[model samples]
Target: MKALAHLNKYLLKYKWYLVLGTVFTIISNLFGILPAQIVRQSLDLVKDTLDVYFAFQGSSLQSGIRDQFYTTIPYFGFLILLMAIMKGVFLFMVRQTIIVMSRHIEFDLKNEIYAKYQELPMRFFKQHNTGDLMARISEDVGKVRMYVGPALMYGINLVVLIVLVISYMLSVSPKLTFYVLLPLPFLSVAIYYVNSVIMKRSEQIQAQLSTLSTDAQETFSGIRVIKTFVQESFFADKFRAGADEFKKRSLKLVKVDSLFYPLVMVLVGLSNVLVIYVGGQEIINGRLTAGNIAEFIIYLNMMTWPVMAIGWTTSQVQRAAASQQRINEFLNEKTEIVSRKKLMTEVKGKLSFRDVRFVYPDSGIVGLDRFNLEVAAGESVAILGTTGSGKSTLANLIVRMYDPEGEIRVDDVPLKDYEVSYIRRQIGYVPQEVFLFSDTIENNVRFGAGELTMEEVEQAVKDADLYDNIQGFPEGFQTRLGERGITLSGGQKQRLSIARAIVRQPKILVLDDSLSAVDTHTENVILNNLSRIMKDKTSVIISHRVSSAKLADKIVVLDEGKIVESGTHESLMNKGGVYFELHEKQLKTEELS
Candidate 1:
C-alpha cells in the first residue's frame, strides 16, 4: 500500500469524480439489500393469507381475505422491481465516474514517465537496457492502473456492503450473526498468506517478461549481423529458453492464484449451512419466526460476495504493489544532468578546456587526463589523434554530455554556470558514429530545427557536398531512408549527418572524424565548402589524415589522452615531431596507393 503513495497527487486531482462515484456506490448497495427484505416480507404475507383463506373457506371472510391478498401482492412486487431498477442506474454511474477517472490518471502517468526519461542523464540510460525501460513504460504502468481502478472499487464496495449487511443481521438475531461470522477470521488468514505468495510470484513474472522483451528487441536490431554470422539457431534457442522460463513463472503464479476463489467459496458455504441449522433450532424453540429466519438468511447471502472478493482484491493489491515499487524506483532516481543556471543572452563560441580530467564510469579508465585547449571565436582548429586519444571525449565535454573534474568555459562563463540548454543549442556536433532517423531525407536534415525552410536545408546540403547525390535520386529530398539510413552509402550517410548539423546554424561546429568514409577528392570538396561556412564561426575538426588538418589555421595532436603537439601544419611538418611523422606516413601511404 505504501508503494502507491506517490499516486496521491493524481488521486487528489480527480477527487471530485471519485467522491461522486463513492456516493453512487453507497446508494446502489443500500438499495441492493432492500429487495431481499421485500421478498422475505412478501413470502410471510402470502403464507398468512393462505392460512386465513383456509380458515374462512365457504364463509363471508373468505372473499375479504382473497381481496386483501390480490391488492398487497402486486404492491410488494412493484416495490422490489423499483429498487432493482434504481440500483442498476446508480451502479452504472459508479462505473462511469471512478473507472473512467482511472483511465485518465493512467494517461497522465504515462506522459510523466516519458518526460522523466527525457530529463534523465545519459549515464542512467547506459546502466539500463532499452527493453526493460520499454516494459516499465507499458507493462508496469498497466499493473499500477489495476490497483487504482478495480482493486480500489471492489475493496471499497466490500467494506460498505459488509457493514450494512452485518448490522441488519445482528438486528434480527445476534446469536445467528455470531455463528455466521465464525469462518471470517479463517478467510482473512488465507487472504494474508495468498497475498505474500502472489507478490513474490508477480515480481518473478515481471522480471522474466523484461528479459524476454530485451531478447526480442536486441535480436530485431541485430538481424543483419545474425544472418551474416548464420546464428539464427542460436538466437531461436535463446528465445525459447526465455519463453519457457516466463511460462513456468506464470504457471506458478496461476497455481497460487487458483487457490483464492475456492478457499473463499468453501468458507462461505460452511457459514451458510451453520446459519440454516442454528436458525431452524431457534425457530422450533419459538425464539424466532420463520419470516425472521428468511430475512436473516437473505442478509447472510448478501455478505457472500464481499467475503469472496477478499481474495481476488488481495491479488490485485499485491500485484500493484510490486509494479509500483519498480516504477517508483525509476521516478526517484537522481538526474545528474540538469540546467539550474540562467544565461543572460545567447552564448558565444569562445571555448576553452582548462586542466580537465575525466574517467569512464564503468571501466574506471581515464578518458582525459589534465587535458587543456583553447579555441577563440571564428577559428578552425583540427585535432589529430590515435584511436584512444580522447578526441571525441573532448567534443562530448563541449556539449555537456558528461561532467569532468576541471572547468570548461564558453565566453568566459563556466560551463556549469551557463544554462545547459543554451550551451548545447549554440554547438552543432557531428560525431564519428552517425545515427539517422527512419524518415525522409528532408525531415531527417531538419529534425531538431522545426522551423527550417527548404532554402536553408538546400544550402546546408550543398555545403556538405550532398546536394548533387540527392538530386540524382528520383524522390530527391523526399526519398525515405531505411533504419539508420541503411539505404545510403557510408560517405552519403556522413554527409547527411553533416547537413543535419549545419542546418541549425550553430555558433560552434564540432566534426569528430565525421568524414572518414569519404574519398580524398570528395573530402577536399566538402572541406572547401566548409571553409567558407566556418569563416565567422568556431570549428573543431577531429581527423587522422594531414590532408584534412592542413586547411585549419592551427592543428593540435593528441596521444594517450594528452596534447603532444600544437602548431600550424607547416610548422609542425618542419619540426619533425609526432605530427611530422604522421604527415610523412600518410604521404607515403597515399603515394603507394
Candidate 2:
C-alpha cells in the first residue's frame, strides 16, 4: 500500500469516480446480504406453517398450509430474485467506474513516465536500457492498476459485508457468533505473513521480467549483427538462461499462492464445522429453533466469502506495492539538464567555446580539455580529428546534450542562460551515426519542419543530392522504409539525414562526419550543394578526409582532446604539420583509386 503513495495525487484528481464506485460497491454488497436474510425468513415461515399443520389436523390444516405455502414462499422467492438483479446492476456500475478510472490513471502514469524520459539528460538513457524502461511503463503500471481497481473494490466490500453480516449473526446468537469468529484473528495473522512473502516474491518476479524483456529486445535489435557474427547459439543460450530464471521466479510465486489460498479455504471450512456442531447441540437442548440454526448457517457462509477474499485482496495489494516502488524510482529521478533562464534576444548564430572541459560519465574519459574556439556568424569551419579527438563531443556540446565546465555561448550570451528548446531548435545537426525512422521519405525529411509544404521537402531532397534516388523508388517520396532505414544503403541513409537537417533551414548547420559513407564523387557534389546553402548560415563540418576540408573558411586540427592547429588548408599544407601529412595521405589514396 505504501508503494502506491506516488499515485495519491492522481487518485485525488479522479476522486469523484472512486467515491461513486465505492458507494456502488457498498450498495451492491448490502443487496448481496439480503439474500441470506431472505433465506432465514423463508425457512422460519416454513417451520411455523409446519407446526400449525401438525397441531391442527384435518381439512382446515391442509387449506391453511396450501395458502401459506403458495402465497408466502413465492413472495420470498421474488424478493431474492429482485435483490440479485439489483446487486448485479450495481456491481456493473462498480466495475465501469472504478476499473475504468484505473485504466485512465494507467494512461496518465505511462505518459508521465514517457515525458520524464523526454526531459532527462542523455546520460540517464546511457545508464538505462530500452526494455527495462518499457517493462516499467507497461507491466509494472498494469500491476498498480490492479491494486487501485479490483483489489481496492473487493477490500472495501469485504469490510462492509463482514460488519453487516456479523451484526446480524450477533442478533441470532452471540455465543455462536463468538465461536464462528474465533478463527478470524489467527486468519489475520496468517494473511499478514503470506502478504510479506508475496511482496518479496512479486518484486523478484518483476525484476526477472525486466531482465527477460531486455534480453529479447537487445537480441532482436541486434539480430543482424548476431547473424553476421554467427553468434545465434550464444544469444540463444543467454535468452534461455534468462527465461529459465523467469520461470523459476514465477513458479515460486505460484507456490506461495498455492499455500496461502488453501490455508484460507480450510480456515473458513473449520468455522462452518464449529457453527454446525455447536448450533446443533443448542437446537437439541431446545434452546434454539430449527429455523434459527438454518439462518445461522446462511450467515456463516456470508462471513466465509469475505474471510477468503482477505487473502486475495491483500496479495494484489502487495504485488501493486512492489510495482509502485519500481515506478517511483523512475519518476523520482532528477532531470539534470533543465533550462533555468529564458533568452530574450534572438539567435544570431555566432558561437564560442572558452576553456571548456568535458568528461564521459561511464568511462571517466576526458572528451575535451581546455578547448577554445570561436566561429563568426555565417562562417564555415571544418574540424579535423582522429577517432576520439573530441570532434563529435564538440558537436554534442552545441546542442547541449551534455553540459561542460567552462562557458559555451551564442551571440555573446552563455548557452546555459538561453532556453534549451531555443538553442536546439535553432541548430540543424546531422550526427556521425545516421538514424532514420521507419516512415515515408517525405516525412523523414520534413520531420522537424512542421507544416512544411511538399515543394520545400523536394527542394531539401534535391539540395542533399538524393532527389534522383528518391525518384527511382517504387512510390517516390511516399516509399516506406524499414527500421532505422535498414532497406537503404549507408550512403543513401546519410544523404537522407542531411536532407532532414537541411529542411529546417536552421541558423546553425552541423555536419558531423556526415559525408564519410559516400564516395568521393557524391561527396564532392553534396559539399558543393552545401556551400551554397551555408553562405548565409554558420556551418560546422567535422570530417576525416582532407578533400572535405579544402573549401572551408578555416580548418582546426584536434589531437588528444586539444586543438593543435587552426588555419586555412593552404596555409596548413605549407607549414607541413599534422594537417599537411593528412592531406598528403588522402591525395595518395585518391591517386590509388
Candidate 3:
C-alpha cells in the first residue's frame, strides 16, 4: 500500500475524473438498494390485500379487492425494472471517468520511463539487461493500470453498496440486521490473511517473470549462435526448466486465490441462514412481519457480489504495489553524465588530451594511463595499436561516451563545458562493431541526419566505396535489411556504418577499426575517398594495419595504454622499432596471401 502511494501525483493530476467516478458510484448504489425496499413493500401489500379478500370471501367486495391487488403488483415490478436501468447508466459513467483516466496515466507513465532510459548513461545500461527493462515498462505498467482502473472502481462500489444496504436493513429490523452481519467480522479476518499471502507471492511471480523474459529474449537474439553450435536441445531444456518453475509458483498462487470466493460465499450463506432463523423468531413473537424477513434476505443477496469482490480488489492492489516498486527503481536513478553548461559551443575539430586516464567501471581494467595526445584543426592522426592497447578507448572518449580522469578538450574548450548534446552532434563516429537497424538501406545511411536527401545519401555511399554494390541490387537504396543488417555481408555492413557517419558531415570524424571487415583493395579505395573528404576536417583513424596509417599527416603507436611512437609513417618506419617490426610482419603475411 505504501509503494502504491507513488501514484498520488497521477491521482491528483486526474482528480476530477476520480471525483466524478466516486459520485457516480454513490448514485448507482443508491438506485441499486432502492429495489430491495420496493420488494418489501410489494410483499407487505400482497399480505394485507389477501387478508382483506379472505374477510370478504362470501361477498361481492372480494372481487373488487382481488382486481386491485393484480393492478398494484405490476406497479412495483415496473419500479424495480426502472431502478436497475438507472443503476446501469451510472455504472457506465463510472467506467468512463475512472477507467479512461487509468489508460491516460498508463500512457504518461510509460513515456516517462522511456525518457529516463534515454537520459541514462551507458554504464547504467551495462548494469541492467534489456529484458528486465522491457518487463518494467510493459508488464509492470499494465498491472499498475489494473489497480487504478478495475480495482479502484470495484473498491468504491463495495464500500458504498455495503453502507446503503446495511443502513436499510437496520431500519427494517435492528435485531435481524445484527444477526445477518455477525459473519462479517470473520470475513474480515479471511481477507487480511489472503492479502498478506497475495502480496508476497505477487512479488515473487513478477521477479520470475522478468528472469523468464530475459532468457527468451537472449535465446531469440542469439539464435544463430545456438544453431551454429548445435545447442538447440540445450537451450530448449533450459527454457523448459524455467517454464516449469513458473508453473509451479503460479499454481501455488492460484490455490490461495481460489480460497477467496468460496470463503466469501460461505460467510454469505451463514448470513442468509441467520436472517431466516432470526426473522422467524421475531415473527413468532409478533415483533416483525414476513415482509421484513423478505427485505433482509434481499438486501443481503444484493451485497453478495461487492463482498466477494473485496478479496479480488485487494489482490490487484497488492500486485500493483509490487509492480510500481520495480518501475520506481529505474525512475529514481539519476544519470551521472549531464551537461555542466547549457550554452552551445562551436566545434572546429581541434582535439587535446592531457594526461588522460580511464578505467572500465565494470571490470576495473585500466583503459588508458596518463596518455597524452594533440591534434590541430584540419589535421588527420591515425592511431596504430595491438589488441587491448586502448585505441578504441581513445575513440570513445572523443565522443564523450565516458569521461576520462584528466583533461579532454575539443576546439580548446573543456569537453564538460560544452552541452553534451551539442558536442555529440558535431562529431561523426563509426564504431568497431557495426550495428545496423532493421530498416531500408537509404534510411540506415541517413540515420544520423534524417533530413539528408537521397542525393546526399548516394554521395555518402559512393564515398564509402559501396555505391556500385548497392546499385547492383534491384531495390538499391530502398533494400530493407534484417536485424543488425544480417542481409548484408560483414564488409558491406561496415561500409554502411561509415556512410551513416560521413552523411552527417561532422567537423570531427572518427573511424574506429571500421574497415577491419573489408578487403585490402576496398580498404584502399575507401581511404583514398576519405583523404579527399576529410581534407579540411580533423579525423582520427584507429586501426592495426600500417596501410591504413600510411596516409595520415601523423601516425601514433600505442602499447600498454601509453604512446610509444609518434611521427610521420615514414619517420616511424625509419626508426626501425615496434612500428617497423609490425610493418615487416604484415608485409610478409600479405605477400604469402
Candidate 4:
C-alpha cells in the first residue's frame, strides 16, 4: 500500500486532469441512473394485464409518465433522451482526459529514467543485467500506465454506479436491499486474499523476464563467438532451459488470471438470482407492479460491472503495487562511491599515496597493503608487471575508484576532497577492453566529446596511427561501424578507441595494454607518432614488452602487488634485477626466432 504512494510523486503534474476526470465520472453516473426512472414511468403509462399491490408506495417501472396518470408523456420522453445524451458526453470527457494524462506521464517518466541511468556509476551497471534495466524502464512502466489510465477511470465509474443503484434499491425496499447486498463482505475478503497471491507471483514473473532478457541480449551480441567456438548447440540448450523456466512461471500466473474473472462472474450471478426470486414473489402477491419488477431487473444488470470493478480494479492495483516496488529498489540504490565534499577544479598531476591500504568490500584481504608511490608533474612513467601484479589496481586508486584506508593526494590535496567528476575530467582512461559503438567511424571517434573542429579531430587520428587506414575507405572517416565495431579488425577497433581518448586532450593519460593488439611494426609507428605529439602531456603506460617501456625516463617493475624494481633501462640492466631478466628473456626469444 505504501508503494502506491510513490505514484503521487510522479503524477503531481497531472492532479488537475485526475480531478476533472473524476467529476465527469460522477456526472455520467447520474445519467445512467435516469434510464431506470424512464423505464419505471413508461411501464406505469401502459395498461397492465394483472393488478398488483404494495405495502409501501412505489413508482411505475415504465419508461415514461402514464397515458392517463401523473404527468405529460412528451416531457418524460425528452427527459429520457437528455439523460442518455449527457451520459455519453461526460463518459467521453472522462476517457479523453485520462488517456491524455497517461501519455504525458509516460513520456516524462521515460525521459527521467534515462537521465538517471546516465548519472549512475559504471559499477552499478556491472552488478545489474542490461536486460533487467530495460524491462524496468520499458515493460514495468507500461504495467503502471494500464492501472493509472483505464483501471483508474473505470474504478471511479464503478463506485458511483454502485452508490446510485443501491440508493434506488434501498428506497424501494430497505430490508431486501440489505439482504441482497450481504454477500459483498465475503466477496471482498476473497478478492483481497487472491490479490495478495497475485502480487507475489507478479514480482517473480517480472524477475524471470529480466533473466530471459539478459540471456537473449548476451547471446545475440556474441553470436559470432558462439559460432567460432562451435558451441552453438550448447548455447541453444542453455537458452531453451531459460525459456522453459519462463514458460512454467508464466503458466502458473495464467492459472491465477484465469480463475479471477470467472470467480467474479459467479459472484455476480448469485446476486442476480436473489433479486429475481424476491421480486417475482412480490409480483405474484400483488405487492409489486410488473413495470417495477422489470426496471429493477434492468438496473440490477447494469450494477454487475460496478460490482465486478471491485475485483477487476484490485488485480491491476496489485500489479501496479508490485511494479512500483521494483522501480523504487533501483531508484533508491546508493553507489559505494560518492562525493560528499565540495568540488575541486584545475588538478595538477603531482599524485602521492602515504601508508595506503585497501581490501575488497564485503570480502577478503588487501589488494594493496601499505603501498606508497609518488610522481612529479608531466613525468613519463612505465610500469612492467607479471600476471597477478597490482598494476591496474594502482592506476584505479589515482582516480578514486576504490576507497583506500589511508591518505592519497593530488597536488597536496587529499583525493577525497576533489569531486569524482572534476577529477575524472582532467584524466583520460583507455581500458584493456576496447568497446565501440555501432555507428559511423566519426561518431565513435567523437564519442560524446562534443563539437571538435576537423583539424583537432585529424590530430588525434594522426597520433593514433589510424588516419591513413580511415582515409583508405571509400567513405573515409564516415564509414559505418557494425555492432561492437564488428566490421573493423580487432587492431583497428583498439586504435579507434585510442583515438577517442586522445581527442579528449586530458592532462593525464592512462593506457592499459592499449597497443597489445597491433603488430610490432604498427606499434613502433604508433609509439613514435605519440612521442612527437605527447611531449607536454603526462602519461602512464602499462606494458609487458620492454620494447614499449624502454623510452620512459624510469621504469617500475611490480610483482605480487609490490614494487620489486625501479630504475632506467640501462641502470636496471646494469643492476641485473627482475626488469633486466625479463628484458633479456624477451630479447633471446626474439633472436632465436
Candidate 5:
C-alpha cells in the first residue's frame, strides 16, 4: 500500500475517470443490495403465514400482520427484479470505463518507460541488458495494468458490498447481527497481518521471474560462444539451478493461496452457525418472531460475499503494492549526469579536456585520472592504447557517457551546459563492436538518418571500401542483414558500420577501434579511402596497427591509462619512444607471420 502512492503521476492524469469509475461501482453495489433485502422480507412474510397455519400461540392477534406480509411480497419481488437489472446495466458501464482507463494507463506507462530509457545516460544501457529492459516494459507493465483495472474495480466493490450488507443486517436486527458478526473484526485484523507477507512474497516472485527471463535471453544471445567452448553441460546446470529457485518461490505463493481461501471460509462458517443457532433460540423464546428469524437468515447469507471478497481484495492489493516498489525504483533512479537547468543548441566539434578526472560509478578505479588533451576541428588524430588505457573512456566522455567530475568542454563550452542532443548530432561515433539490426542492409546503413537515395548509399559504401562486396550479393543493398549482420563476414560488418557513420556526415567522426578484425589488405584500403572521405572533417581513429595510425595527422600512444607519446609517424620514429617501439614490434610480428 505504501508503494502504491507512487501512482500519483498516473492517477492525477485520470482523476475524473477514477471518480466516475468509483461512482459507478458504488451505484452497482447499492442496487446489488436491493435483491437481498427484497428476498429477506419476502421470506419473512412466508414464514409468518406458516406460523399462522400452524395456529401457534397468539395466532389470532397476528392475523392482520400475516395478511399485510402476504400483500407486500409481490411488490418486494418487483423491486428486487428492478434493482437486479439496474445493477447489471451500471456494472457494464463501470467495466467499460475502467477497462478504457486501464488501456490508457498501460499505454502511457510503456511510453514513459521507453522515453525515460532514451533520455537516460548511455551508461544506464551499458550496464543493462536488452531482454531485461524488454521484460520490464512488456511483462511488468502488463501486471500493473491488470492490477489497476480489474483488481481495483473488484476491490472497490468489496468495500461497498461490506458496508451495504452490514447496514441491512443492522436494520433487520442489530442484536442478531452483532452476535453473528462478532468474529468479523478478528478476521479483518488477521488479513491485515497477512497482507505484508503477501506483498513481500509477490515481490520476490516478480524479481525471480525477471531474472529467469534474463538468464534465458543471455543464454540465447551467447549460444555461439557456448558452442565454441562446448559448455552445454555447465550452462544446463546453471539453468537448472535458476529454475529450481524459481520453483521454490512459486510454491511458496501456492502455499499462501491454499491457506488464504480456507481461512476466509472458516470465518464465514462460524458466522453462519452463530446466526442459525442463536437466532433460532430467540425465535423459540418468543422474544423474536419466526418471520424475523427468517429475515435474519437471509441477511446472514448476504454477509458471505463481503467476507470472501475482503480476503480476495486483500490478496490483490498486496500484489499491486509489491509491484509499485519495483516501478518506483526505476522512476526514482537519478543519473545526475543529465542537464536540467538549460538547453544549449549550438555545439561545435572542438573537443578539449583540461585536468579531467573520473571514476566509474560505484567503483574506485579512475577511468580518466588527470586526462588532458585537445583536438582542434578538422584535425585527424589517432589514439593508440591497450585494452585498459582509457582510450574508449576518453571518447565516451566526449559524448557524456561518464560525467567527469573535472572540466571537459566542447567548442569551449562546458559539456554539461551544452545540450546533449546538439553535441551528439555534431559527432559521429562507430563503436568497437558493430551491431547491425535485423533489417535490410540499406536500412542498417541509413539507420536514423531518414531516407537516402541508392546513389548516396552506394557512395558511402564506396568510401568505406565495401561497394564491390555488396554489389556481389544477389539482393545487393536490399539484402537483409541477419541478426547483428551474422550473414556478413567480420570485415564486411566493420565496413557497413563505417558506411553508417559516413551517412551521418557529422563534423567529428570517432571510430573507436572499429576496424580491428579486418584483413590487412582491407584495413589498408579502408585507411587510404578514409583519408579522402574525411578530408576536412576531424577524425579520431582508435587503432593498434601502425599502418592505420600512420595515416593520422598525429598519433597519440597511451599506456597504463596515461598518454606516453604523441606525434606524426616520421617524428615518432625519430624520437625512438614508445610509438617507435610499438611500430618495430608490430613489423617484427608481421615478418615472423
Candidate 6:
C-alpha cells in the first residue's frame, strides 16, 4: 500500500473518472439489490394470496383472487427484469470510466518510465540490463493496471453490495443476519494469511520473469555467437534452467491462488448453511414467515459474489504493490550527470585537457591519469595507442561522455561551464564499437542530423568512401539494414558510422578507432576525404595504425594511460620509439600479405 501510494498523483489526475466510476458502481449495486427485494415481494404476495385462496375454499371470489395473483406476478417479473437491465447498464458505465482510466494511466506510466530511462546517465545503463528495465515498464505496469481496473471496480462493487444487502437483512431479522455473518471473520483471517504469502510469492515470480526475459534477450542478441561456437544446446540448457525456476515460482503462486477461491467459497457456503438452519429454527418457533426466510435467502445470494471477490481483490492489490515497489526503484534513481548551465554556446573546437584524471566508477579502473593535451581550433591530431592505453578515454572526455577530475576547456571556456546538451550537439563522435539501427542506409547516415538532404547524405557517404558500395545495392539508399547493421560487412559498417558523423557537420569530430576494420588502401582514401572535409575543423582521430597517424599534423603515442611520445610522423620515426615500432610491424605485416 505504501508503494501504491505513489499512484495518488495519477489517481488525482483522473479523479473525475474515479468519482464517476464509483457513483456508477453504487448505482449498479443499488439496481442489483433492488431485484432481491422484488423477489421477496413476489414470494410474499404469492404466499399471502395462496393463504387467502385456501381461506376462500372454492367460494365465489376464489377464482377472482387466483386470477388476480396470476396477473400481478408478471408485473413483479417485469420489475425484476427492468432492475437487472439497469444494473447491467450501470456496470457498463463503470467499466467505461474505470477501465478506460486504467488504460490511460498505463500509457502515462509507461511514458514516464521511458522518460526516466532516457534521463538517467550512462553509468545507470551500465549497471542495469535491458530486460530488467523492460520488465518494470511493461510487466510491472500491467500488474498495476489489474489493480486499478478490474480489482478497483470489483472492490467498490463488493463494498457497496455488501452494505446494501446486509442492511436489508438486518432490517428483516437482526438475529438471523448475525448468524449468517458469523463465518465472515474466519474468512477475513484466511485472506490476511493468504495475502501475505501471495505477496511474497508474486514478487519472486516477477523477479524470475525478469531473469528469464534477460536470458532470452541476450541469447537473441548473441545468436550469431552461439551458432559460431556451436553452443546452441548449452544455451538451451541454461535457458531451460531459468524457465524451470520461473515455472516453479509461478506454480507456487498458482497453488496459493487456487486455494483462495475454494476457501472463500467454503466460507460463503458456511454462511448459507447458517442462514438455512437459523431461519428454519426461527420459522419453527413462529417468529419468522416463510416469505421472510425466502427474502433472507435472496439477500444472502446477492451478497455471495461480493464476499467471494474480497480474496481476489486483495490478491490483485498485493501483486500490484509488489510490482509498483519495483517500478519505484528505478523511478527514484537520481542521475549523477546534470547540466550546470543550460544556455546555448557556440563551439569553435579549441580543446584543452589540464591534468585530467578519471576512473571508471563501475570497475574502479583508472581511465585517464594526469592526462594533458591542447589542440588549436583547426588542428587535426591522431592519437596512437595499444589496447587499454586510454586513447578512447580521451575521445570520451572530449564529447563529455564522462567527466574527469581535472579541468577541460573548449574554446577557452571550462567544459562544465557550458551546457552539456549544447556542447554535445556541436561535437560529432564515432565510437570504437559502431552501432547502426535496423533502418535504411540513407536513414542510418542521416541519423545524427535528421534534417540532412539526400544530396548532403550522398556527399557524406562519398566522403567516407561508401557511396559506390551503397549505389551497388538493389535499392541503394532505401535498402533496409538488419539489426545492428549485421547485413553490412564490417568495413561497410565502419564507413557508414563515419558517414553518420560526417553528416552532422559538427565543430569537433572525434573518431575513436572507427577505421580499424577497413583495408589500408580504403583507409587512405577515407583519410584523404576527411583531410579535405576537416580542413578547418578540430579533429581527434584515435587509432593504433601508423598509416592513419602519419598524415596528421600532430601524432600522440600513449602507453599505460600516459602519453609516451608526441611528434610529427617523421620525428617519431627519427626517435625510433613506440610509434616507430608500430609503423615497422604494420609495414612488415602488409609486405608479408
Measured over all alpha carbons after superposition, the RMSD of each candidate to the real structure, in angstroms, is 2.0, 1.5, 1.7, 4.5, 3.8, 1.5
lDDT of 3 by residue, 1-593 (tens): 88788889999999999999999999998998888888888988999998999988999999999989989999999999999999999999999999998998899899999999998887788889988999999999999999999999999899888888888887888888889999999989988988899888988888888888899999998999999999999999998988888888888888998999999999999999998898999989998888888888888988899899888888899999999999999998988677777558678999999999999897888889999889999899999999999999999899888888999988788898888888888889999989999999998998968597788999999999999999998999999999989999999999999999999999999999999999999999999999998998999999999899987899999997899999998898899998999999999999999
Write the residue-wise lDDT of candidate 5 on 1-593 in tens digits: 67777666777788778888889988988887667656655776677566675675565756776667667877887898899899999999898877778788999988888888877776677677676677678877877887778777777777777777778778767888888778878887888887777778888887877787888888888888999999988988888998899899888877776666788778778877888888888878876665566656666665676667666667776776766667666667667676654566654467788988877765566777787788887888899977888788777887677788778877787888866676677778888888999998899888866778888888889988898998899999899988889989988998999999988777888988888888788888888888887787888888777778988888889776678888899999999988888889999988898
In lDDT terms, how accurate is model 6?
A: 0.90
Each prediction's TM-score versus the true structure? 0.95, 0.97, 0.96, 0.89, 0.90, 0.97
Question: How big is the positional error of residue 100 in model 2, measured in Å on the Cα after superposition?
Answer: 0.6
Candidate order (TM-score): 2, 6, 3, 1, 5, 4
Whose lDDT is greatest here?
3
- Across 305-359, the per-residue lDDT of candidate 6 in tens digits comes to 8778887899899999999999999999997666666657788889898999989
lDDT of 4 by residue, 501-543 (tens): 8888877777777888998888898888767645666677777
Superposition-based RMSD of candidate 6 using all C-alpha atoms, in angstroms: 1.5
Q: Is candidate 1 or candidate 6 better by TM-score?
A: 6
Worst 10 residues of 1 by lDDT: 336-345
User: Which structure is stronger by TM-score: 5 or 6?
Assistant: 6
Expressed as tens digits, the lDDT of each residue in 1-593 for candidate 1 is 89889889999999987899889989999999888788878888988899889998999989999998999999999998999999999989988988888898889999989988888877788888988999888898899888788888888788888888888888778999999999989988887878889999999999888899999999998999999999999999999999999999999999998897898788888988988899899989988777777887777777778777777788888888888788888899988666657664676688888999988786687878898888899888999998989888888888888888998888888888777776787889998999999999999999787698899999999999999999999999999999989989999999999999989988999999999999988999999999998988899999887888987889999988899999998899889999999988988998898
Query: What is candidate 2's CA lDDT for residue 444?
Result: 96
Q: What is the lDDT, from 0 to 100, of the residue 550 in candidate 4?
A: 73
Off by over 4 Å in 3: none
Deviating ranges (above 4 Å) for candidate 2: 59-61, 284-287
lDDT of 3: 0.91
Name model 4 segments beyond 4 Å from true: 47-85, 282-288, 362-366, 589-593
Count of backbone clashes, every candidate in sequence: 0, 0, 0, 16, 0, 0
